[model samples]
Target: MTSTEQAVETFDSLDPTTDEVVGTYPVHGPDAVAAAVGRARGAAEWWASLGFAGRAERLRRWKGVIVRRMAELCDVVSAETGKPKGDAQLEVVLAVEHIEWAARNARKVLGPKRRPSGLLLANQAATVEYQPLGVVGVIGPWNYPVFTPLGSVAYALAAGNAVVFKPSEYTPGVGAWLVRAFEEVVPERPVLQLVTGFGATGAALVRSDVDKIAFTGSAATGKKIMAAAAERLTPVVIEAGGKDPLLVDADADLDAAVDAAVWGAFSNAGQTCVGVERVYVHTAVYDEFVAKLTERARQVRPGEHYGPMTMRSQLDVVRRHIADALARGGRALVGGADAVGERYVRPTVLVDVPEDSAAVREETFGPTITVTRVSDMDEAVEKANDSTYGLGSTVFSRRRGMELARRLRTGMTAINAPLSFAGVAALPFGGVGESGFGRIHGPEGLREFARPKAITRQRYRMPLVMTTFARTPKTDELVRRLVTVLHGRR
Candidate 1:
């Protein structure tokens, strides 16, 4: 699996539906990952030496490359992950937009800026600057291969750090396509490198001496990655799995809400980290909403609209969740146990499932969603906020959309839309609880890949200096008086 020469050999990426190899990519192991990181270390220095403007130019060029070759890359992504070409292209388009935003906004988000040192330190001039953290190791997931990873990759590049990307084994070709395209514009060095393999390879990347690691995957693997990175005290940004909820209020547009739930839950075979795994509909509109949702779910045929599960092992997990829900008296409104296919899981919509069932409590990561009836909007908000994972959520209502969206404890909430928060490049994306920490996309993404360096230079020596042994009892009394004058009212 390790590289022998500059030219690497090939490995197969299979199509889940046919169990056939659709594309071949280089299988890179620890040695190769380490080499790529080393190269990235050098490239990062060069990229960082170039000021913000210089980096922006190169990033824009990379963006152009992605835009121009969007179709070719989408074809590779489609073949590797078994996703429809349209879906692949959509993800790539979003990724390119993110890259462009990161490039244009990096200087404003991360450059040195003046900050007031508070009344106490008014004599001192304070400035804060975000410095690039040498190299970033990004371990991406198979679902939304382009968009998800670029949430980290684009920001890292724009912030002046080179990236070593280890995409999911199922989507290695997509990863290679991205890195190759990046090289076409920024060919001075390996600013972006691809390392492709299984879990062992991902573990190796986390253990490597990279400055920071951004991981998107299951929470179990996230814990392992965190433990590995802790050995070196390496900071990490993890966007783990989520059991996200889409709340439908009594006043919500039933038609629009149904459309969002179906598309959000079933799209991409329901393998999205922030996908709508749970739906809490207001009891006032429960029956109507469920009927609409069920009808819409039936309209989405797998393979044509979405792809088979890229990871074969996930099928069992999906089946077990369905079986657990069914055993607990949950009725499948659409597809049931038989929906779990050899490769693709048909859209399954279940109702009356116990809240504690695996399908509700765990991250299903499949084309299945649990529809529960909540008494009112308050109950819907409560139920939605109860999950341990709080990545992203959706709220649909006419009058109370924004208010209810703010009440949910998730990191990002979309009002009257599903996952729309992610599309608005200005909003930060990440999660609290077990869903993981640190942010990707928006200003937060730029800062996550950088370290804050606070600088304070004495403008002039103050008459009352506190740092030296030269401070007298009289000066200490005067300082106390000054502090009292400032804080006594508060």
Candidate 2:
């Protein structure tokens, strides 16, 4: 096929329900991605030369553009991903907040600071400062298209780096809208660039000469990105998949637990990386908790509550998870195989699913949750931390919420709430193990895009010289005597 025909024949973003093509985007290849990165390198210099104050002003102007044109951006998101306009608006608003915070706080968080050189280097005055990487390549997820990508993009820009963003194939138009808005604010250079395609395009971006890469996607894909980055020794920040859990204690507020579970499990059709996928309830209130969850689940009707699954291929995965749970002697009290609709999966709540089942262990990125009864808080913590993924988690308890939250080996935990850690812009957002590494959203986010530079200046020459072409036995003996005097067996 001709290049034009080949490009046209590539997959198009479709309306999930009607299966009609909603938009056509170029399936960017290696050449296109390389060219974009090349342009971004030049942009980085211009952006960095603006200094912190100038960049902050430009960022505020960009924020105004996004706030004023929120509806237009949401419309593009809705058309491309089939998510509700309200949900799209919510993501965009959070994204704008992040952009504003990054712009305002980057200098303070990343500016130079003094540090003690310790007695070993007593004659030196040590200092540390964060320097921006030249260019950053961000591969974002379709879910929360704006918020997730901007979590990286905004911080990178604030740190004085140019960004080349590759939004998910399912939400390329949303990515385009953001890039266009940013260009208007910094029209002197291509400070923000966009490339749209599938996995191949993403692979191209990872292998490019960008100084750093920020990826938000499945853990499986995160591994691939990390491995590819290793080729160029490129630093990366990965916000991968999560099988997050919400624990309930015997003395917990049943109403709060139920509310958190409902919203955490079913919101955005359960496509969130930090969404609750497992619930470990204290056996004392297991039955009561399950009943409350079921009632709340019923109240959340799929169509009015959320839109269709953005990726059509995810339908089979959702169906398989439910079927596997049932075949393994699990019961779906609220929704079963029949709940898997053509485009949207109705909220499914399963009980008695084996802990080893895919529905429990794997990331079933659908509107399905598995609830299990645990003997006590100990068992709850163990099961919650047993997963390969350790992103964010939630705990609902009156007396032991903080203790239990600390025990779980995840990055961040919300007490009496679901995914609240993400809403708090001051806290860091990331995970350990399979959930991925690196953080975003706060001071940690600002430093991720920067490299630490250590500076030391000699205040004066010490009597005991350590780094000159001259050495004396008396000086060595004095140094040993001083060490013994300070830290000897007292």
Candidate 3:
């Protein structure tokens, strides 16, 4: 059979709300993935040679194209993910900002910088810089398809690497749209390429001859990717699941806290990895907080406010969590066990849930939250930190917001707000523990896809001659004396 005939397998991307096929794409297998990577190798060399200024200029042009065609891309995102145009645009906007940031800041973050040569090597000049890692394989997730994946993709591109992206099968059209837009600005080579398929395609990308891998999904999937990449000794960045929490203190603005909780929990059908999944309110205002949260949650309709669960199978997980919570003596203030529908899940606010319950311990990835009342800020912090996943958290305290936020065992935190850290272009973003490892924003992200290169120059010959065999007994005694003088006191 010809190559086209051999690659005849295809799949349909469906609208989450309607279950209608939005688009059909080929199921790219190992051969296709390897071919894409091989093409990227040449692209990587050419892209890196462009240097920071040349790449930034092209990236800026790409941003303009994205902005000009924002509505069209948003439509595609909405079609596949079933999110409202507004929600889709929000992620797109964040993605554009990230692209801009990565392009503008790559030089400052990865450029060579002079390093201080210690007294022992006073005649030597030293500097360090980060260089591109050739080709990068990005396996994106369906939820927040634009914002989450671009967190790594844009940074990798700015660091002068060619990208072979394998977006989630659920949103292949969105992925294709982004690649096309990039090509319009960068017609010289295939700097960004898209391969659409299921999990097998992603596995192939991981095993291919890529320099590094950046994956965003469940912890189980992240572990599998890590194991596969280990065979090639390829470095990876995993942005896995999160069971984030929000704390409401006695002095916090009740109205603001309620609004944040509602938006964070119900927005995007609560599929956000950093969305507020749990809330801990001080006993002083627990009753009032619950009343307001329930009232606000009731006003959030799935289709109008957010959309249906993008992946149909996610509905089962949401259903199971709510059922287990209810069965374990938990009560739903708004939508209960019946909240989960065929396509959409009604906004559900659960209370009196056991701390060890699945709904609290695991990432629900749905528009549901558990509100637990605590006696004081201490209990609030303790309970909030009682999870294996430590990704993001929010603290709503007028007087001690910063203090509490600092104490939380999370990678990122917001004071008196919700999901604020994600919107900023300068702050580093990632999580520890089960939530995943490595960062994807700020200077750290630019360096994640690049290898650090250190350079040293001999300004003059040192009297001691420490690094050569020409050193004599006098030189050894001098080195020992210098070390003793420099470090012995401490």
The global C-alpha lDDT for each of the candidates, from Candidate 1 onward, is 0.90, 0.91, 0.94
Clashes of each: 0, 0, 0
What is candidate 3's CA lDDT for residue 51?
98
Work out the TM-score per prediction. 0.96, 0.96, 0.98
lDDT per residue (tens digit) for residues 379-404 in model 3 = 99999999999999999999998899
Indicate the residue-level lDDT of 122 in model 2: 89
How do the residues 1-490 of candidate 2 rate in per-residue lDDT, one tens digit apiece? 6766644325578766567787788888898899999999998998998988999999999999999999999988888777788988988888888988999999899888999998978889999999889999999999888999999999999999999999998888888889999889888899899999999999999999899999999888989999999999999999999999999999999999999999999988998999999999999999999999999998898767888888878889889999999999999999898998888889999999999999998998899999999999999999999999999999999999999999999999999977888877777899999999999999999999999999999999887896676887887898889899889966
Of the pair 1 and 2, which is ahead by lDDT?
Answer: 2
- The residue pairs in collision within model 1 are none
> Model 1 compared with the native: what TM-score?
0.96
Best-first order by lDDT? 3, 2, 1
* Residue pairs in candidate 3 whose N, alpha carbon or C atoms collide under 3 angstroms: none
* Candidate 3 global CA lDDT score: 0.94
Better structure of 1 and 3 per TM-score: 3
Looking at model 3, residue 459 earns an lDDT score of: 98
